[model samples]
Target chain A: MKRIALLGMPNTGKSTLFNRISGASARVGNWPGITVDLMSAKILMGGHIAELIDLPGIYDLHGFSDDEQVVRHFLANNALDLVIILLNSAQIDRQLSLVLQIKKLNLPCVLALNMSDEAKRAGITIDAHSLEQALQMPVIEISAKYGDGLPKALQAASNILNQVQQKPSPNTIRQLLEEDNQIEHEMERLIQQHVQIPTSLSNNATDTLDKILLHKWLGLPLFFLAMFLLFQFIFTAGKPLQDGLAWALDWLRTDVLEIAFASTPAWFHGLMLDGIYNGIATVAAFVPIIVLFFLVMAIVEDSGYLSRAAFLMDALMAKMGLDGRGFVMMLMGFGCNVPALMGTRVMRSRAMRLLTMLVIPFSLCSARLQVFIFMIAALFTAQQAPLILFGLYLISFITMFMTALLFQRQYKSVEPFILELPPYRLPTAKQILLRGWLEVKHFLNRATKFIVIGVVLVWLMTNFPSNVAPASAGTYAGQVGLLFAPILDPIGINQELAIALIFGFVAKEIVVGALAVIYGMQGDALMAQMATQIDWVQAISFMLFTLIYTPCLSTIATLNSESKSSAFMWLSIAWSLGLAWLVSFVFYQSARMLGF
Target chain B: MQLLSQLESGQSGIILAIEAEESLFHRLSALGFRVGKPLSLIRRANFNGPLHVRLGSTDIVLRIADAMRIQVNTR
Candidate 1:
């Protein structure tokens, strides 16, 4: 199969074209000896099965960004059949330089001008035929978002791959270095000859919108309002769907599976129903919220508001040794830390990315929110529940910034903050749904293994040896909890709650479920037991611990994969764990001493 | 010549020089910030954060620190 790679600058619609051609079979490819994963898929291009690799979007090939290095490294290692360089037709003047750099590699190439429709609307015109003749390559104008002229683009790529091989250019690096001085002149000449642009094209729409949206006084509040509405929408819309899913899973276990397992031993039944089924079902029920969250996030991202958000938040983030993009990633962490950690790829500097990773786990993600909500409702009154929950959120932010403040000196970012603000476009429904679906699929594929392993391990530790009642003091899990009892005593966490903490380490959503199993009850019964078992202060300490402790197993896996540094990931885990203990201890002791 | 960061919102300028590290200069140039190129300050974010500068037809958000490295003469 021929290997074709798609390369482009960021926001060039390269991903849209890749998805347009490859459809849903696209999977991430792990290049040999490289930690980076590139998205690639095998597709039948004009009756020839070819592997298409979507390389990371880069500004310049010689630049030192992680993405640029990944692209350069991929090029150095792989002998590609063809490289399809995609340029945004609306901004081809500066983007064309990438084509020149790729051409220096002496590889077979096809040039695709994406967003042709947008370019045309902006009163820009390109003589594709003249540009094709000038560049001596197949140049096609395509609207990747609308499926316009895509067949011709694919056919051109296929034709180039089938043509006879060109001899490798001798002294390619030296030749490229010599031509680098003249690259700008060549780009200008090509544009001068084949492209036309009105001197004062009408683009007041963006200006008017920015004036209001980025208003000095309103930008910050508007940003907060947007985030507030996003969560309100996610919860109000997602809760019913989630509760419905939970109900179905419960019915499946009790009504159908319970009868089927009745003839089996009690231990086996418990392992299947409570251990595997319950564990997996709890996570599965969260799928709707994740999907909705990403769907909204897709709109926020593709609509171009996210960049403005970064612009508004950059000053504050700069003080924390980060850029505005890091702040956006932190907010994303509130939905789920795994994706937010994965999203650290936006930061080009390693120091900034690592620092962002360190701060994300303290986001009080929806999983921990579930545990906190349960605890607050069980221990506090209706009036105080909201206040206490708000307090937890406040603590989450304080701790997150404190972590950044503490570590900014260790991980100082020297890279300049330079991000493009793409003109606002109405995001198409097709692209939004595709993005939402793909992210959800990615989440399940990467997170399922660790979650399953974590849940089953918790089950085994609580139910093993077939002697002691499940989750009792005689069990192994109880003994592990006992080992930490003394250290946890000062924080108001007993051995039983310590076991819940161990379960919470796997995933915070499981903490309440673990409490149910430990006390041998569920729903109101469990809440009643919780209220009698622990005071409001202990409940508050528990919530604090849950809020600040290590992120879920899946987030740890993502941190390790995304950062590609086990030491960094381990350090993040240790830091969060230590912080959680200290914070809980201080809060618990102070509240008691203050006569609360 | 004045720093690009010092330019008033809606003011246009010609790039004179970029006194940044090689990588950052290259990045700025790749985004169409070359000597003799014309750019305009679209807006300044609150608290002197980033300046939204328009180069050719592209809009870019860059920090004041980065903007300060570029010398520009207002038109």
Candidate 2:
């Protein structure tokens, strides 16, 4: 198969173009390194199955950044049929430098002037024919977002692949670096001759929006407002959808499944309904919340306000020895810590990535947030619920910041923060829906397998020693809970809660599911039962514990892979567990002392 | 002549030279901060934070310390 690598400066719409051409739903954020790892997809082009490799966006081939090194190393070590160098047509002058540098590799390449729609809208014109004449390569104008001119670009690339011989060489990097300024000069000359910018073309819209959004006084408050509304939407708007799903799942298990499995053995019925249905349904109920979250997040990110958020937060983030971009990753941690951990690949420094990874688990991921929301609804009044939830989010940020501050000194070197603020563009409905669907798909794919296995394990632990009543002291789960009862007693957690926490270690979404199974209640009945078992003070303590506890099994697996150090993984677990215990203990004790 | 950081918001300048250490220099230059490039300080974040500067069609935010290392001549 012909291998073609997509290369471009960060945020030049390369990943979007890749998705458009290959029909792969790779993440397309308005920020850099969204395609952190090299992503390849097989696309049928010109009646040929071509493998397209999407490289991480790079600013310079000779630059020392991690992404730059990945691009350089791949180009040097791998034999490529052709390279498609994407350039943001709106910023062709500065982006042209990279094009010149890539051309120095003497590889068979095509120049894709991406974002031509934006350029045309902004009244910036590029003479592609003249550029092709000067650069001695095919130049194609394309809009990756709308899938315009993609077939022609792919055909052009296929044509180049056939015409050029594969000259695999590792010496390209040294040659490119040795002739650095020459490339810059050539780029300057090309821009002077081929690209024309009208002085009347102004970015007044972006400028006007930024003035208000990035204003010193209004920036932070507006950001908080946006987040508050997002959570508000998740709870208020998502409730009916969540209830509908839960109702349907309950009807399936109780009304339909019980009738169908009426003659089955008691044990089989319990395993299928109590174990699998309850566990999967409990996690699945939150899918609406997750979908809504990703929808709002995709909109925010696509609007390019995410970078402005980073810009606004940079001053505060720097105090903790993290860059503004790390703050963006931490925010992403709210959706799912695994991808957020992977998102740390965008960080330029190893120390920065590690530091960000340590703090990400504290970001109150959707799983933990669902648990907290459940607790708040069960234990608190309607008016007090949002406030309590907001307070928990506040605590999450504080915990992450303090953790970064405490561990910042351990990593001696910190990368200086440098970020590009892309212009704010309204995300198309298609892009927003695609991004949300991708996230929900990811959550469901991971949740079904992890939650089912976790639920089955918990059911086994509670039901074994067959002579004993289910979930009673004679069961393995009850015995383990009792063993830890002494340590947990101070935090006011009962044996059932303790057992649920143990299951939660497998996946946080299973906490509520385990409780539902152990207590033999579902939906509102479970909420009522939980209300009777735990007081508001104890409930608050439990929420704190859940908020601070160790990362779920999947997050730990991601941390292990991304950090690639068992010691660091263990350190993270220990830090989170110790902090959770201490915080919950103090909260419970203090509430008692204050006569709550 | 002044440091890039000293240029107030809306002030335009031509980069004369970057006076940072080797790695920082290369990183800055890679982002089009080379000598003779025209840039303007779009805004300086509050609390002595990073400066938002525009070079050609790219808008970049860099720390105050990094801005100080880039020597520029006022337009």
Cα lDDT, all candidates: 0.84, 0.80
How many Å off is the CA of A430 in candidate 2?
Answer: 3.4
> i-RMS values of the candidates, in order?
0.7, 1.2
What TM-score, computed on C-alpha atoms, does each candidate reach? 0.68, 0.61
lDDT per residue (tens digit) for residues A1-596 in model 1: 88888999999988998998889989987985357888999999867889999998999987758897677667766667888999999888779989988876777889999988888986589999999988888999988899989889888987877777863433453455446536755776797788743233235687788888899899999988998898788778988998899889989988999999999998888788877886678558657866877777777777788899999999899898978878887987887787677667767899999999999999989889999888887888899989998999999999999999999999998777889887776776776787768877876776676667777887888887678887877788899888888899999999889888888877787788888888999998899988999998899998899899996877876777778889998999999999999999999999999997
Error in Å for residue A542 of model 1: 1.5
Model 2 clash pairs are none
**Model 2 regions more than 4 Å off:** A1-202, A231-241, A255-264, A272-291, A328-354, A364-394, A410-414, A440-448, A506-540, A551-570, A588-596
Query: Tens digit of lDDT per residue, candidate 2, span A1-596?
Result: 77778999999998788877777534332223233456788877656677788888999887768888677667766667788999999888778999887887787889999889889986699999998999999999988888888778878887886674755564665455547746656887897688643222236678888888888788778877876676577567777997899789978888999998789988888788877876677567656766776677677676777778778888888889887768877876776676677657656689988999999999998779879888888889999998999999998998999899999998644455777777777776666777768866765665566566766777788887778878766789889989988889999988888877877786787678777877888989999999999999889988898889875766775677778888998999999988999989998999999999
Residue A555 accuracy (lDDT) in model 2: 74
Tell how far residue A388 is off in model 1, in angstroms. 2.1
